[model samples]
Target: MQVVPARRGRAVRLARGQAIRIVNTHGSQVVDTWAFNADDPSEFMSMEHLHASLGSVFPKTGDALYTNRRRPILTLEEDTSPGRHDTVIAACDVHRYRSLGCTEYHDNCTDNLHAALAMIGFPRTETPSPLNLWMNIPVGPDGQITWGEPLSKPGDHVLLRAMIDCVVVMSTCPQDMIPINGANCLPVEVHYEVTG
Candidate 1:
């Protein structure tokens, strides 16, 4: 595993067969994420469609992922690494910070994804939806949920093979919260290996 840096405001592209394993070197490191069809830049992801496409819930093993137009995007073909991943946790934005906590985290994944969206010229204004792949945030039986601790370990990661050429953008969460972003700033690693 490589602990590389995803500098703030930068975008990344992961080709087919190449999967990204976002590591929470410490724990509770929040990672806001997004995916798009590389061939069709205008075509992007919609959490609504994704959740519905997977049968009105966050994707699980063997779930069928579709694009904005309901075209096949990816299948949860494998999740052998991490024990859990949050599909509903929303990436915090400047507004959220001002209202919920701090405005300092405004330049995090949400902003980065928005910059990326504008750069790609994708018509998205409803706020960029990011999938928290490794951060530990869960809902309890009493309907009370807590976003704390770490879900995956040092080597635990998620592998995603693109059904089509796609753009993957991530924000190495800089939110230095005890329950989110690990309370300590650190780096992450990304790798791609050809399979198909």
Candidate 2:
């Protein structure tokens, strides 16, 4: 078990059949997560493939997260804060902050993801869309998405079991411009567990 500080990142390697539990320690915080084949970083989790295969926009227990090659990377085993995650949003980055009227440097999820990957010696590359855990962005009748306060509370967690050996990166989202993190960003914790 490891506690990932607010607006920071962490990386972990999971062997096949291992599992990771992501905790919203402070509640209402968003954690952006990415996964890739441990031996081949180029084959990363794919939001498109996952949605296509599951035929749903939100993740649920029993759903298998797919990789770029349409192979199962991880399976959703438990979701204490169920149905409150996002699979359609990309991680926040510098360009997004700039466009949002920020001129100075701001901590963003993209950099966090890259830093986490670098920690594990993975080369920098284009990041795939993240599986936003504990985020709340609902689509309205007009097909417009609006950010809302996360439904997750303190100590709430979701566990994902790895279907294949993989590298997982996580970013405690630092977006202070929206209500995604209840109007303030904070840290979270992660627990890596291996089962027989």
Candidate 3:
């Protein structure tokens, strides 16, 4: 188990069949997460393929995260939260912060992902859309999405099993401009375990 400090990121290598559990150590925090094939970093987790294969934008237990090539990379094995996660939202970037009226440089998830990957010698590139764990983006009756508070409390977690050997990157989301994370950003914990 490792703790990823607030507004920071962590990278972990998971062998095939291993599991990574992300814990919301503080309630209402969102974790921006993505994964890449260990052998080929260019082939990263694809939200489009996952939604197409699962027929739902939100993942649940038994659902597999698909790659850009539509191959399984990880499987959603367990969730202790309210099961409201977002796949349509892109990771927060500097531009996004500026758009939100911030004139100064702000820590963003995109950069966090890149920084974490760089530690392991992975090339930096534009990241793919991430799986936002513990985030709440609710669709209204009219189909418009709005940000909401995370349903996960402290100690709540979601476990994902790697279907193939992969490198997972997670950003303790720093979007303080919005209500996501209860209007304040906080750290999360990552636990890597092998389940036989």
Cα distance off (Å), candidate 3, residue 78: 0.8
In candidate 1, the residue pairs with backbone N, CA or C atoms under 3 Å apart (3 or more residues apart, or in different chains) clash, namely none
Stretches of model 2 off by over 4 angstroms after superposition: 185-196
lDDT of 3 by residue, 25-141 (tens): 776778998999999888889999999999988899878899999999999999988899999999999999999999999999999999999888877766899999988999878
Lowest lDDT block of 10, candidate 3: 185-194
TM-score of structure candidate 1: 0.72
What total of clashing residue pairs does each candidate reach? 0, 1, 0
| Top lDDT prediction, candidate number | 3
Give the C-alpha miss distance for residue 118 in model 2, angstroms.
1.1
Stretches of model 3 off by over 4 angstroms after superposition: 183-196
Each model's lDDT: 0.59, 0.85, 0.86
Collision pairs in model 2:
6-187
Measured by TM-score, how close is model 2 to the native structure?
Answer: 0.94
